[model samples]
Target: MSLVARIATLAQRDAITTTGIVLSGVWLFLVALFWLLAPGGEGTQGGIARLVVMVGTILPLVLIWLAVRTARAIAVLRAEAADLRQRLAQLRDTAAPRGAPRMAEPEPLAEPDRQPRAPAPVPVAPRPLSRPLAESRSPAAPAEGRALDPVDADTLILALNFPDGPDDSLAVSALRRALQDGDHARVLRAAQDVVTLLAGQDLYMDDLPPDPAPPAVWRRFAEGARGSAVAPLGGIHDAAALDIASSLLERDEIFRDTAHHFLRHFDAMLMRHLPDMDDAQIAVLAETRSARAFMLLGRIAGVFG
Candidate 1:
């Protein structure tokens, strides 16, 4: 990006830092102009007054700039720390031992001679064919018989929550599985983008406790209901989280794009499974970290009015 575009992007991501930089530039320019135009003939007292005025004007601006820079540095560190932790966890999972090898079996010579004799065939019962889970559950599935696998669904849910720590082997395994899946991979990537953005702003889905809405409300959302009719689906009401998410959606281009992308995939997945899921399953899904992120972002996006 060009300098101007970079500045614009910075302004969108961190308005306070951009504003401070602009104000500092303008302040310094005005001070320089004043010093250059002012008469030079003055006593020691007059010189001291000028010095004091300059210091007074520059001090507060310097402090503001310092504070903004410090905040930016802290945010960067937090994001880096999170990235490092995730990388370490991934490394641990990758390096983990699979299992012990099986022992070799002894050769069977006498048994081979006995097996030469003809053996009677056993009757087997015919098994019934069934439709894909996705097709059986809802017509809203993206493809006719390409339902999301139950294992994939579980893995996606686990991935959305993210691994709590290096010890969370189950979540790590699920995340790996989700990434390997073609369809689930898209949703995982989108969710990761949004989650990372949210983390940059210090807004973790795990920290936001949303109001528990009924499964029927979630079902309505899955069925395409929006606005006030399904507003309850956006149960996250944390003021700080709402304000930050709302501001980002309105200003940050990257964040807005990822949030929208994540929303679309999540909604599609929900629609495909909600019809077939029981109330308990829906409730379990609603409690997931990804679902919470959805509620927060969906509310900010006005999907729930």
Candidate 2:
């Protein structure tokens, strides 16, 4: 049998209850019609009419109760069907392979003459914060033929002081010696000494600690204020130095600013002494074996060939 026919048979249960209820409804209707149309006049006739009226009222109540039960059964069957459909959908979802995409509804076919359009381009996501510092480096430009400035020297000085100023004994000694000698030639020599010390450290510049400050700190540092924290060179006043160093070193900034001490003594000493030296003295200083720092500074300051 078809599904509808099967469900009808289940509700009827061999059709006995359904047939009895239908007969009962028709009987009660007929009896009511008779009583309304024909009124009995005498005592015996009135008693028989009252008996028929009582039977009609009782029959309808029983029929109504059976109808209510049948309706409840149909409602229960509908609920079960709905629950089964939901479970089936859930099972299908669970059974799908781990890597497989979920099945989507099929699209309607287009006109025969039309070709399929290309899919939309997917958006690219940005790199995460944890990406390697090396990958974040900007392309380095050619330094040759480019004129260096005091800013460049200043940036280099900041790079040297990253985390903290030059702690190298040799460079410190030279700086102190120049201060004591008070000679322009000796000051030139001292600048070269500092450069030589930095050059040696440059070999392992990659080994320095990472910049702990955020990009905002670097931005502010570029503006002239030191960073909010201690720098690798050990102070914030020259935070822009981080940018220059990162460019030269071709790495990301990753150093923390700590403590609260402030000093511009190194850059000050260079600025004060560099201007006193004549071109000839600077030239002499640049020619020395340890004169790399002096050459860099002199080129930046336009003081030496």
Candidate 3:
């Protein structure tokens, strides 16, 4: 895009520098007008004279500050605008347009999993958290196993971030470090860090408690780690993951390990049977999610024995 387009896009965006530019402009204009309209001090040369002098000095200072502020704002806005234009151009090139952007259409802002027509995001499969447990080494597993990554954990945790929130980069890093250290307990703690954000009544990002709820990378981790068999009983449709995660919030501390372990087993089975299953079969699978959740929480008897 051209320089003007880039500047316009940055001005269109939300940023602190943009606010500074606006306030500076208003102050500069009002002060300049006062300098023209106000009369000069008539030998009132004392404290009042000093106050008048300060006001006159402020005019030049505000002017200089505004000049600096405008230059910085323009520089940042232009850079951001260029970045946005490049992305829009790339998107226009890669994926075929599914349909028009509509009021109810899948938003560009929605998590990548939320898109349906573009491509089939991988169906999840079961696996261990810290290390691959014994049963996972068998021939039945797909030769390559999905690693337990922070990004995936964040995506699974999507129901947790507030609207227009900052990207979940920090949580993703923390979770990844925890996983690399094989400290699964710390990973659970990382997951719990987002509990208040996801469970909060306020939906706006402004009111969010400074930190995003969770990393988007792997928020839907139960399914990401295990696959869909342990997916929230709700389908992966609107608000399904959110509702399911909300339900698990209270029990997460108590059941973290069991939920992780059971999902690993259940996901392996689902992946194998998935080819033979239809929607009816899928519904049955989803319906059992609550029971699976119960089993995780120790409210139900184990069927393995």
Against the unseen true structure, what C-alpha lDDT does each candidate score? 0.63, 0.34, 0.35
- TM-score of model number 2: 0.23
Candidate 3 residue spans exceeding 4 A from truth: 1-44, 67-71, 95-305
In the range 1-305, model 2's lDDT, one tens digit per residue, is 33664565466553545666777787778777977898766656577777986866786768776775776567556655665455434533443221111222323323433433322222112111111111001112223563322222222221222111223333222322222222322333333233322332331222222323333333333344432231321312233333443343333111101000001233344345345444433333222322322223222232221
Better of 2 and 3 by lDDT: 3
Q: lDDT ranking from best to worst?
A: 1, 3, 2
- Give the C-alpha lDDT of model 2: 0.34
| Residue range with the least summed lDDT across 10 consecutive positions in model 2 | 253-262
Deviation from native of the Cα of residue 169 in model 1, angstroms: 1.4
Could you tell me how far off, in angstroms, the CA of residue 13 lies in candidate 1 after the best superposition?
Answer: 26
Cα TM-score per model: 0.51, 0.23, 0.23
Residues 127-246 of candidate 3 have per-residue lDDT tens digits of 112111011000111124434333232222221111111233433323223333233333333222222222222221111111111222122333343234323322223244334544
Predicted model with the maximum TM-score: 1
Query: lDDT, candidate 1, residue 257?
Result: 78
State the number of backbone clashes in model 1. 0
Per-residue lDDT tens digits of candidate 1, residues 219-243? 8988889999998988998999999
Higher TM-score: candidate 1 or 3?
A: 1
